[model samples]
Target: MNIHEYQAQKILKTFGIKVPYSILASNLEETVYAAKKVFKKTKNYICVIKAQIHAGGRGKGGGIKIAKSIDDVYKKSSNILGRRLVTNQTNKKGKLVNKVIISEYVLNSDKEYYVSIFYDRNIYKNIILYSKEGGLEIEDISKKIYFQKIDPYIGLQEFQIRKIAFHLKMKYSAFNNFIKKLYNAYIYSDASLFEINPFLITNDNEILAIDAKVRLDDNAFFRNLSYKEMSDEREYSIIELEAKKAGLNFLKLDGNVACMVNGAGLAMATMDMIKIYGANPANFLDLGGKADSKRIKKGLDLILKDKKVKLILINIFGGIVRCDIVAEGIIKFFEKKNKINLPIIIRLEGTNVNIAKKILNNSKLHYYYVTSLEEAANKIKVLLKNELRCFI
Candidate 1:
């Protein structure tokens, strides 16, 4: 989950990482109060007011502003608060900026650095990325010559740390201390990504994390409250929560065809195929393995409630979920709902396949059953085309 810089900084503090003191404000008055409260000693102290949104590129979006004076701080916060900040990652309408985090800004030269640790599921390793050139062009700099390694079980070992430090041309004494501390922080926080863009070097030649951005793994939420609290209300819609509560994974998309699949990979491929067939998928719904009749019923109910859903598609490549079990689930859902009017296309290929066809054929619901994925897509396209014509 993406969090505000303030929240990420708080996590850093817990790991003994030095960070600036800050306060959060959601309004103009609060912004002024925060500016007054946080930066008391230094009149000419540099301050940054950043919009507390889930997405990134805040600087480019005008969500991040630097103020030279208290009045400037208040002015910048006023302009940012209650405004819609658009980033490359945000939707066209942009995300609403309701809160701003004001913090003391640090000063350093442009010769910054970048470091990050990520879990690559495919390689099944903890990968650490580092670059001497930090800030805006870090990614571009990475392409030139950077360092990355994949360790099976352990994270950045001492030798690996030394290698990165040496490769980045960091001073031996400082790099050793920085590498050890940073590596420990990466492990302790269970972060998927820990990045310090422009990991600054002060005039005293001391390394400081001027800007922090960390993304923790959601699967680790049971242990990480800091990441959980950073969640934004606008990030999840009502339909999404409903699906989650029902033990289904759902992502709402701009499409008319609603999909219900058994696995994540299957769901993604289904969405891709639907798009290829000139049909849009309204949702990515994964019922998961071992889903029973009740769960299936819940999934169907959730999809049917979406007014934009003109066609429903159930594609299950069952292994743990037998075809008969799925058939029973669909039957139970229709019975409970007392009616089924939407055009549904079903494609089941796995255990008890013939039995599933038998059960579906006996049902009174208006639906089509296809063995081939292409046939299902074609049928859904035709159904949606008819729906458009009827609407017109």
Candidate 2:
């Protein structure tokens, strides 16, 4: 779960970290008003209007603007709000910018740095990575990075914090306090990543986090109700949001084959099989154990929304869910929806398999029923290859 920079900054403030105060604005008038208010408080007319999308490279995308005057704020906000923001990471079509963060701009930082702490899954340990070199080129930045591995089981040790701060050449007293609070907040929030990019040191020797990029662990949402509420639907695709609301596990991928399976383990195995068969999976849609016609139809409908999906593979190994019952759900969906165009390959094993076969056979749809995994795989490869035409 990704949160906007403003949202992350607000959380940082609660942890006793120093951050430039900001107001969330969604329009031109609000932006103007926010600029005026911030200027009044800071006694400085200059402020920054930043786009509130989840992705980075905002500066290059014209998503980050420095407003020198109230007019500048209005003009920049007018151009940004409700416009599509294209960055290095975002698709060329871009993500729509629905809001902006009008914040008091910090001027003339003596130095800028990047610092992040997160669990390193490869080694199963928490790591803190800091670098003086901060920019778009990750490879270059990584080469100059100084890192420290923290024991997740024991948490961040006091000596380890001092060691990192010293390595970064931070001699100030306040920076130490800031690091402690930052570490505390990161652990308590169940954050997957807590990044402070361009964490600057002002001439006055004060530590300030100039940017916040935070991602909280979804599995830990049970302990973070407020964090869950901070979810911005704008960051997600319509189909993705819909799937989540429908209480189904789904993720869109880059492929032509749309897979709908019963269990997560089975869904993964199905995708792996598809790959082995020399075809990529378009999406992962796990229907779970108990699925009715409504749920099945909804899943199918969502999968069909992706135009790249040329085939639908329904793999079900029945135990609690009878094959015949699932087959009924499948038939019910196709009977109502249009575009009975794509070939559907179904491999149903276990209870009532014969009955399920009979139902599908009687449906008179362009369906392929394979009793063996190898047969299903071979059929998928042939159909996928045929549908994919040559340059001619």
Candidate 3:
């Protein structure tokens, strides 16, 4: 799960990493107060106001502002708080900013660098990426970056640290200590991604992390129970949180076809087929391998909440989950709702498939039943064509 930048900085500080002194504020008055505290603590007049959101590119989205005085801080904080910040990493609608970070603004850094550690599934190893060039335009200079893959069994080697430090032209002793601490933090926190952009070096040779972006592995949340408090509910939509509560994986998308599948792989394939057939997927809904009637109803209810959905596609390759149970859920849903305006296309296979087909046939609901994915795609194509014609 992704946490706000302020939270990431706090985490890094726990690992003995130096970061800019910052305070969190939720309103204009609190922001001014925080700015005063930051300036006093850091002995600096200038402070930075950063909008607290999960996405990056906040600087470009006008979410980061440098304030020279109390009045400037108040003005900048007022503009960021309670605003919807749109960035390249976020959707067009953007994310709402309810809080801001007031930090001491550091100046005259000797050098700026980038450092990040993440697990590479393809190589089945943890990789550390570093670059001498670090800033908002780091993506454009990605070719100049260096990568070092670590052996999980043996951990980060001393030789690897030396290579990175030498490449960046840094003193070996200082770089070794800083990198070792960072690697330890990543392992202990169960972080999937730990990134520091603009890892700063002051004239006095003091190393500091100017910006931090961290994403923890959700599967490891049980071990790191305290991290739960860092979760910001505002980062997610209401329906998304509800799906999480129901133990279903759901992601809303901007399209006409809503998909419900039993597994993540199948869900991806279903969405791909929808796009190939000249349509877009409205959402990615994975019912999982052990879904029952109640869970299926919850998934369907979540799909129906999206007004953009013009069609529903239920594609099940049941192994651990019974297809008949899925059919029962669909029947129960329509029975209670009684009148759904949209069309549903179902493709069921494996684990009582014939029984599921019989159940669906007797349900008396207006749905298109197909035996194969190709047939389902054809049915969806014709229905979407009709929907477009009506719109015309």
Candidate topping lDDT:
3
Per-residue alpha-carbon lDDT of model 2 for 202-242, expressed as tens digits?
Answer: 67777888889999987899997889888998888889899
State the local distance difference test value for candidate 2.
Answer: 0.85
Q: Which model is ahead, 1 or 3, in terms of lDDT?
A: 3
Shift of residue 313 alpha carbon in model 2, Å:
2.7
Highest TM-score against the true fold, candidate: 3
What's the alpha carbon RMSD for model 2? 4.0
Candidate 1 global lDDT: 0.78
Model 2 stretches astray by more than 4 angstroms: 108-110, 120-123, 135-140, 172-175, 262-280, 288-293, 316-325, 337-339, 347-380, 388-392
Ranking by lDDT: 3, 2, 1
lDDT of 3 at 105: 92
Clash count per candidate:
0, 0, 0
Model 2: ten consecutive residues of lowest lDDT: 133-142
Better of 2 and 3 by lDDT: 3
- Candidate 3 is scored at a TM of 0.93
Give the TM-scores of the predictions, in the order they appear: 0.85, 0.84, 0.93
- List, residue by residue over 1-392, the lDDT tens digit for candidate 3: 89988889888889998988889999899998998898889888899999999999999999999999999998888889999999998899899999999988989565789999999988899999999888788888978999999988899998999999998989987788789989998999999999999897766676889999999988888998989888887888999989988989988888989999999989998888888889899999999987788888999999989988888999999798889988998888878885677888889999999999999888777788898877888888999888732110
Runs with alpha carbons beyond 4 Å of true place in candidate 1 = 41-43, 137-142, 145-147, 224-230, 275-280, 304-310, 331-343, 372-392
